[model samples]
Target: MTTSEDTLESHEVGLAAPPGEPLQTLTAAEADGLELVHQWFPAPLTVRDGSFALPPEPAWRAVVHAARRHLEAMVGAVGRLECPELGPLTQCGSAWLIRPDVAVTNRHTILSLLDDVQRGARTLRVNLSAEADGSAVLHCPVTRVLYIDPIHDLAFLRVKQRGAPQVGLVVVDSIVTANPVAVIGFPSHAEGGYAEPEYQQIFGDGWFDREGRGFKRISLGRLVSTSDTLLEHDCTTLGGSSGGVIVDLVRGSVIGLNFGESRDRRVNLGVPGWVVQQRLAQLEGSI
Candidate 1:
């Protein structure tokens, strides 16, 4: 979907922190986590046939091995959806499996699809994979739009499961400032003039597809602040990152759902994990 300037401006207005709240500095552990992320990617190596070239350094390989399980979990849990009506290459947004047959994403991302479903269209599908060899891709048809959150940007969907792994969730009560986190999803160009240049610098020219979008990748940052229902983080995100999970690097569990960003891109916003848990519980009870 095309993101208008007005839409981005609205995000800035709503996500901007209340005046006078100070930003927190990263702790030693947080710094170590961020350093590990840097070591994992290093620089824009190259892209071949829509896949990234592995860094050959033994040290880089060691880091990958150390974090392999978490990294794999990130990619396995999150998947991208495409809606031809939205645009041939327009990714609806990132959605992560919460249950074998249930997924969560931004309401805005599936708004058009919701309309189409009402008119008897059934074209939505989620493409998921757990292996880098392209050997285990799972294409699950989205059966229906389960619910559109009345207050937040969250939405849920029912998909035909084919062994998709669900991500573990940690309630917000356990999260704290300076906890290092990562956002995993498909990121397109940053339309707000915020993260595009940095993305280009880090990933290089070969990183994007013909339509200028990057594949599943991890962005590292630490939680800056939180409230009853919202989480503010500095994780670099773009247009298509909506609904991506904010995972605690140390715990390897999801703590938030990405939804919006400040105009400056320094502050990204997400629905707190507890809020998501509560919503899902309500939905389950009603069903």
Candidate 2:
């Protein structure tokens, strides 16, 4: 009994005794749960990022199908905001849903209309369409300003609706240049001062045709460069294209928003998604 007691004490202290002694190490299950320590030196290791391959037709098909579903949801989330006159006047810029009832858009879209709303003119009604059979069309009013970027041309508004299908914002520490992106939104055909729209005829403004998910246009472009404070690109766009989502297809999320374009419509600028994420944090209570 005394010898057995001594062995027990030694084992408790992580030690082994004489012959027939158990090893001074963890059991198989315990060792399996612990990972071996990895040592690193400053100069040996290099970064190797893993990426997916969708080369095969089946693989790419699944990718496109998923992206299309999100795109259609985005169309339902977008709404046409017109300056509330006796009747709907000129069509303003676009906005996409970030939250169920809250959306982000260009600051210019709501700035001029702010005065009218303040003086009890009328709420800015956002017209959203259904995704099936044109079953219903919703006109939600922007009841509050959520957030606005200081230097970037972006704004967030809360609509008076319980919920709406939304596209998620892809947040990342840094944006790599020359990454391919999809500029998804409803673009206008007008160039000479008016929004002479060409894409909204079949589906109407700010909607997706439920019949075949028709009328949603996507412009392919790549990140040109990230200059000091702006994200530049060479995507062709029109006036009504402002506030459209800049989607990163491979990541399957919105990396930024196309808010402006160069005079030639070649060098477009977008508000990066990181900026939007930061602004949302500041709007916690401002609701």
Candidate 3:
């Protein structure tokens, strides 16, 4: 147990764990949980070479099918934003790809794209692909300027792509207070990529509290606190991962999109779905 004084000192330095230790280490169970969750998705399923092909049991198969449908709802709808003036953008730092959906990252992750486009880039594209590795894809060109919210640092793009999901754009409504959430996306230049997403559940209710601004980005205690803007949960995300979706496990839907990680390395802030939805709605009338 740590004292209030220790907590204050740690916060002063923006560290979550004590010296010489890291925050959010995965236990054996947590690691296994992530793999199990991914197995529930079918399109991403593949029998690795030399691995034993154990047939999924009847009950397990049912679970997998259901999970796959829900995940499709979350991953199927992605926003593609780009500016040709900046050159073909690559998934580098804090950027990544998930099958069938090329995510347009948050303002901080790909600010250059936004800046150049606003400055009058003649062409821009947002493509949704079929693999996390960016294999087999559908490209969407940004033909019409949509909505943008500076306060929330979010934007919407009306893409031009053939055979896209009928839905305009979907976002997560809310996150479970003390349940699990998963971040799905590709990483920066990772060759041996995991076929499916990683899932991590919050063990307790620990939150990021900064004045009345109330950024929720920690999982501790039993009272799990949350914010309409920021989100806090126990999951792993890294470079090339900025625009990925944060799915609320209980709801089986995306609640947020990864934007930035806190200095503590324990929390990541996401653009809430409500913000994304509001921007898109405004664009509908204009379009």
What lDDT does each candidate get? 0.62, 0.51, 0.40
lDDT of 3 by residue, 145-198 (tens): 454445554444455556844343345565455654555543332212332232
Candidates' TM-scores? 0.73, 0.62, 0.55
Clashing pairs in 1: none
Write the number of the candidate with greater lDDT, choosing between 1 and 3: 1
TM-score of 3: 0.55
| lDDT for 144 (candidate 1) | 79
Predicted structure with the largest TM-score when compared to the true one: 1
* lDDT comparing candidate 2 with the true structure: 0.51
Model 1 Cα displacement at 242 (Å)?
A: 0.8
RMSD of each: 6.1, 23.5, 12.6
lDDT of 1 by residue, 97-119 (tens): 78777888877777655767767
Cα-based lDDT at residue 168, candidate 1 = 38
Question: What local lDDT score does residue 269 receive in model 1, on the 0 to 100 scale?
Answer: 81
Flag regions of model 2 displaced more than 4 Å.
1-66, 86-90, 130-135, 162-173, 191-216
Tell me, by lDDT, which candidate is best.
1
